[model samples]
Target: MTPRPGRADGCPAAAGQVPGPQAGDAPYARLDTEEFTATPHAVFEALRAEAAAVPVVVRGGIHAWLITRYDEARAVLADDRMAKDVRHWRDFHAGLVPFTGDVAVAARRNILSSDPPDHTRLREVLLSAFSPRRIELLRAQIARIAGDLLDRIAPRGRADLVAEFALPIPMTVICELFGVPADDRPGIRTWTEALFHGAAMERMAQASNEIDALLARVVEIRRADPGDDFTSALIVACDAGRISSEELASLLRAMLAGGNETTANLIGNAISALLQHPEALKLAVGEPRRWPQVIDEVLRWDAPIQNSLWRFATEDVEIGGRLIRRGDAVIVALSCANRDERAFAHAAAFDIARADRGHVSFGRGRHYCVGATLARLEAQIALPALFERLPDLRPAPGAALRYRQSTMSRGLISLPVQFAATPGRPAATCAS
Candidate 1:
């Protein structure tokens, strides 16, 4: 019996029927649990070959697709037919974990969840604070933060790099950029951590409330005491009627949430990768000029963000020889796309020398990460500084290292390491 047209049973139309330009492939209806837990590279290979636009039935009887191949993923991400706004799909929004208050309200304001005029307006206003010139100016400050963090950790002989250094470089820089007070950092960090990990419905509700209250306070403080910071810049934009107060708050939350954990993970993942691959470290230390390449490789090898935010099909679409009807949920597997053999040579190898750029780690098209330059600056300074300070750094003995258990962000929860201490010396000594 032929499946009824436009009926939502999480199944594609009959064989020989092509739905549209963005339709998904077969074998999607039976997505395996093991697929999510497998080493990311393996999953990438499977998605590239078998399911570039693979369709699957997600929780709550919703039909969705995963775009895996590099070129295909880019097309899907850049294409207007594949929409970022999930509100277009009734089933998609219905399945989402609900939010309690303003945090949930703020989430709706971020550029990631919006389209066209609103997206363009919000991006233009926020771009003023994140311009390349601005990011370059922050380089020296970022370096100082990296240096100070290394100075603190050097005396310990061994330190949990994630907690002691990796996490602080971006967090400190972001706080300074946003005018978040020194005293409020610890509390902000704690709340941010909870929000990132709060994936389930109940936890998400709690996180939403926490973030809402925190941001409300920060906004109030900024209003009373404006200064030369992103928050102040946003306030100025709002005063000019370029953005609404609600939009400003949402943008601020997005900037903080996007910059903090993502950059921290990049640092943590890069450090862990360096420790695991000494040859890469040697190249980085022996020739500091290679830092940019190393940073790129680390990002490709283990991206900080594991998955792209959900995208919805605006109309009937066909991709990879399958048809997907209008209003279906789709997720672009960025981690998988980064390793697509079609786009990258020796896709799985961690070669610092690989001549590869244009990685989708920053994503593509309208919703590409606005903080890419800042993130690169932070990693470029932080990773090299880490190796230079702890030339003999190694993972701590008898301590288990664990990656953050999250599908959203790929990072180490803790990274304990041990090394011989430099006695009676400046805590941090630069080479040459």
Candidate 2:
């Protein structure tokens, strides 16, 4: 018997019969699992070739399609039919797709998960805050933060760069942006770490509550005593009745994650990439102008955000000659698309000088990351500063980086490195 259209059972459609899941392909359940995070590139490359729109079972056996081809991924991301509104996702609404902790918390309300008017409204409010001019204005401050982080770590000779340098700069910036007091930052960092990195739902809930309480207090204080900060600016908007309290809270939460996690990872990933290629490291360290190119290449080669958040098909749609049933969850492999053989020559190679390196790491269309400029600025300043401070900086001899267990964010859990303990280091030790 012909299966009913949109049936959950894995079967070929009568008209557009696409290939089923291949043998030995890892299940979507592996997302956020240790194995998947360690090495997702190989699998993504395989999928892009074999099945650009591959079907897999996620946690709880929820069926979803993963798009890997550059063209297809961009098309899906820009297609309004493939909406970001989780409210319309049948499986999630039906409670068939179970999400734990931070995933569930973030899905409730945020620009990342919303669609249409809600997305527009949420995005508009924060757009000005992340404008290019604003981000450029942050350059000097970012450099100082980077220098200070290095000063403390340089004396140690050996340190986990991820913990000592990469993590703190963005965390500090985001806290300052949100007007989070210095006293509250440590606790906020703890909550964010648990919320994003922890696997247990119970612990995640606890962290979320703690964060919520802290944010609430910040909002109240901002309301009472408006300051020259992002949160205070938001409070002004709230006072004018442009946004509600709930929306304000959700926006702040989203910014905290967006502002800190991705930027930190970008810095770490860039360092790792350069360290592996000494020539590139020499170029980046010697010529500061090449930093922009290096940053762009790093974004494409080892993206901080590997895959886009979930988007569900609003109706049956044909993509890459495959039938996607309505309400089916679709994820665009941003890292994979950036490395698509069809789009980029020598896709696997990490060449900073590569001219064709426009990547979807910050996403595309209306949902493109609002924090892109800030992230790039932070990386631009942070990378050069670290290299200048410790020109002989190299990865710890035998240490390996463990990636954070997450499908959405690609970041190292730790990155150990050592540099010579030298005083009054020349800013440009390499030949210009």
Candidate 3:
């Protein structure tokens, strides 16, 4: 396809000479600072009601486009003209540091940041390990982990759901998958948290270094005594000349971060949503089969990953009446897209029974989350088990639920809940 021409306003003019929103336009320029921090549904509604493609100017006068309309957002996400590689940007070299640094590096490790052939190759390699059959085998293990955690916290009468249950469950699973030692789980968790939440570049650098060091150790261990784990499998692939060490490291890092943190946050967010809607919890508890629907609603209501990492425009492209210029950075608001009224009726309403649970929570196209099935399985098993075991589960009185201050993952830091204890079952016995 021939590349579209750039507009006079520096936006990409659509084919057939359609003009996008002009620069300095009030509707396009209005900044919603709260959208960055507010409930995703609220942000979605605001953007839908305002304009289609809003021109958002951030710090240092950097101009990026925000697509709020569902169709437009989907088009942008799937469009071949849009580039996920930051190197395509005019500021490619300048953005390299941030891209490799903590926050961006964490986001970029996955195939989400690559374009075409590279994205296809990287995704194909990882998808082989994360196939549905492989993830299904992990289900029994996940259920046992969830049950074990519940056994520990059930007697406490009151427990922080996030810390006690949600965070540890998926972390354990990811560790097992990666062949990380049980004793080293805490360090990995701390490192991930620090890397995700680190504010300064130095802190991020330190966290990155620590993560690299840990992965190096893991690689060395697998080299000496490889096992039937993803790490070992990756090492084998590298040795067989199927992939380079750098590619192996990137894939492993991506798997660790993507599988661990996102799934944990998804569980935490789902639990919080269930706590807020007791009816939904009751339905899920009574009908375990309804877990699929319940989890979908939870994902739609409170997505774990907020905005997709950044996609730079490869060439001029017009979307939703906005002409985006070549090299422009576009942030696709997945959280916003989930609640778009055009795609979902009564979008803001948290109805688990809603037939249209369409959401971009796992993203779309070639970069969709590889571990999505595993994440869904973990949530399905954990949520029903929690509600079934503790039917009266509710947030503790006067306890304040605090969300983590992050643009990437949206989840509660702590969710204190009070519920009556049920007869205990060994973690291993509870899965069946």
Candidate 4:
């Protein structure tokens, strides 16, 4: 049943739940550094060595404790005391958060920002669309999409995988799944990128508003003429009083925007990781059975989502011997936790052969990514298809690798590559 005492705002006043307003501490770490984008694990490693959690300043002057260690990160992600509701954030209550009204709605209305029973209800209805059988049924379509992408780039002998293939596959699949029109998908992708990545931070507010307006329109259309789409299902739930109208719109954005970025990054990251490690690439490309292991190592070594969303304490709690007071927000450094030596041996090294392939990349407990299965299915299909078609994929010489600017999401802005343009489908790289 209900595990902890809730506040007047309906947030749990449990262990991770933050207490009322109190004096705050100066931030000890800044997540906006260039180093974070280039080498985030280094930052996480430094912080973990100091403590499990340390006070940090995120962008927009949001002060919170960054959870670096694996044990603390896992605990805080699942701890009932660490609530997701933005109202539990003391900074928001004090008008210290810089979010505008529209931006504020985006921050607080989604499932990521909600706690039970609202989170419970929203997640229950949302997860129905991502069920195992439904995802498996999509396997053929995902494979077709991957093959079609390769066809377009195979003859070029050179390509920016991120722009040409990796980005479009998930963006296309997810948008179509949600009933988003083909013509409108490109604009939505642009807006979503600007909202999540820091390089385009100047347009963050504009992008948020545009995305919201578009999602609202989608919700309105589904309400009148229902279709075979997840958005339509969410509309029915809204009408059935299963979730609020606000949540319906937010979930649509969450699903569309969140699904696209995570999978896109996963594909790009997997390709890059495999290319860097020739032996691993040989195993992944030459040995079809080990694709799953290759995908797991890429996820753990360089998670698509770096420092993910925030969690606030509804009340005071102690983590790693540090007393985190109520109202203090916490960001779990997923990238750091996955590489934590305490959790996995030789965590720093990217080892595909490691038997302990577990990681918190998609998160844990109640907030675990609903699209985890879909993401995996897409990557499992994408990787083998690319290497099989190209067979000799390798990084373009002198092209420097660059990641997107957002501290929250870790993904390549561009992934340049050179490959052989064979006449027919290249012979299978993996054994049949």
The 10 consecutive residues of candidate 4 with the worst lDDT sum are 1-10
What range of 10 consecutive residues in model 1 has the weakest lDDT sum?
Answer: 97-106
Task: Please provide TM-scores, in order, for all candidate models, with all chains considered together.
Answer: 0.86, 0.89, 0.87, 0.88
Local error of candidate 3 at residue 277 (angstroms): 1.6
- Top-scoring candidate (TM-score): 2
Candidate-wise lDDT, in order: 0.73, 0.78, 0.72, 0.79
- CA lDDT of 106 in candidate 3? 29
- Would you list the rank order by lDDT, best first? 4, 2, 1, 3
Give the 10-residue window scoring lowest on summed lDDT in candidate 3: 94-103
> Candidate 4 versus the native: TM-score?
0.88
Candidate 2 regions with alpha-carbon error over 4 angstroms: 1-33, 59-62, 424-432
Give the TM-score (vs. native) of candidate 2: 0.89
Error of 3 at 357 (Å): 3.5
RMSD of 4: 6.8
| Two-way TM-score contest, 3 vs 4, winner | 4
Expressed as tens digits, the lDDT of each residue in 74-114 for candidate 3 is 87777888777767655434332232232265244456567
